[model samples]
Target: MIKVIIIGSGNVAQHLIAAFQDSQNLGSEIELVQVFSRQTTNLSHLLDYDKITDDWNTLAEADLYIIAVSDDAIADVSSQLPFKNRLVVHTSGSVSLNALDDNNRKGVFYPLQTFSKNKAVDFKTIPICLESENATDFQLLDKVAKAISDKVSAINSEQRKALHVAAVFVNNFVNHLYEIGSEICQEHQVPFEILKPLIAETADKIMVLTPEEAQTGPAKRNDTATIEAHEAFLSNENYLTIYKTLTQSIQHNGKKL
Candidate 1:
């Protein structure tokens, strides 16, 4: 059995705890022995009070220690681990393997999905990005990852960093665009629900078609009059600048065709 200790009570850490807890069906291949949180109350709702501790010295001896802390705190937290030469990994996309204290066997087990405390996610669908400083530790991480997720890949720190940046563009930036769209709808007294199907279809289309191939808009068609009207219609200077920039990008991309 892989005895695991999770260090954090945030969204990702909570989700991982749930995933490992449910993995008991796999003949208890993965076990959540303990969880460490500075504010033990934060994890009390998820784990038994006995299983949660604020003291680092009380951390149990586990096969792996997964630090799911924030990016800035990873180094400090890992450095504080009392033991050494254990398989210690962090759940971060941007932070490198070097962030962990070298006193332990370092690795990364980054899940390539956005996590929310209220939203329930299927662990099997989330791709687990695994990396290790050595071959033995990599195999161990792979085994643990496979127990909870169906999709797992060996991704280096550099590749993981690139993927993190791309995720910001696709998830974070695209969500911001949705916010702007909702704002525009509110300004015009139009129900934002009216755009739901369009948004769904746009997302579905990209599954089978390249984003460039799926591109459709006044900008893609080089409709200068329509573009100018949109620019003028956007009363907000910031919105107008965004509209012009996107339109130019679409036109430029279309030129390559």
Candidate 2:
């Protein structure tokens, strides 16, 4: 069996563990030998497992070491590992594969999704970005990735970096827009619940249509009167600025109804 050790107790680590457990392909071929964390209390959910550890020494026994810690601490944790030829990998999108200097055979297994401890992920649909130093390692990582996800892609470090930035725009910036809409509803004494359907529809449409094609609203339609009214209704300067900026972006991008 291929022994695997994961380092971290955060949402990513938890999600990864859950994914591994769900993968039938890896059930008999691979085993999760250890889960390392600084504070064991954070990993109470995994207490049933006999392989949980708060110390780095436990990592010595595993054949594959996965540093799922934060981007800043990947190198720190990797450098301390005792095994010289052990295959080491990290689950990060922004951090490059070369970040871990202890081993030259490092790779990245980035899951392109926002993970929260309370929220479960559908690994089957989520994209798994796999990369490694050479063809042999890349093939190994690809096999591991395909076992957990149907949408696995062999993306290099530079492409992975670009995708990470794109993810921030689509996920982070779009969520901020939802927040702004909620705040607007709250301030106007309107139920924020009313916007839920619209938000869901917006996301749903994108699954079947391009964001540019799904674009709607006064800006895309060039309804200046409605745009002016929306700007006038805004009580917060920041909110109005955001609205104006997005409107301009949509209009300048030549989005048509």
Query: What local distance difference test score does each model get?
Result: 0.92, 0.82
- Model 1, 42-148: lDDT tens per residue? 88777889899889878899999999999999999999999989999999999999989999999999999999877799998999999998999999899999889
Candidate 2 residue-wise lDDT at 212? 80
Per-model TM values vs. the true structure: 0.97, 0.93
Can you give the lDDT of residue 80 in candidate 2? 81
Q: Which runs of model 2 end up more than 4 angstroms from their true locations?
A: 24-28, 47-49, 255-257
TM-score of 1: 0.97
Tell me the lDDT of candidate 1.
Answer: 0.92
Model 2 Cα lDDT, one tens digit per residue, 160-242: 99999999998999899889889888878999999999989998999999988888789988999999999899879998888
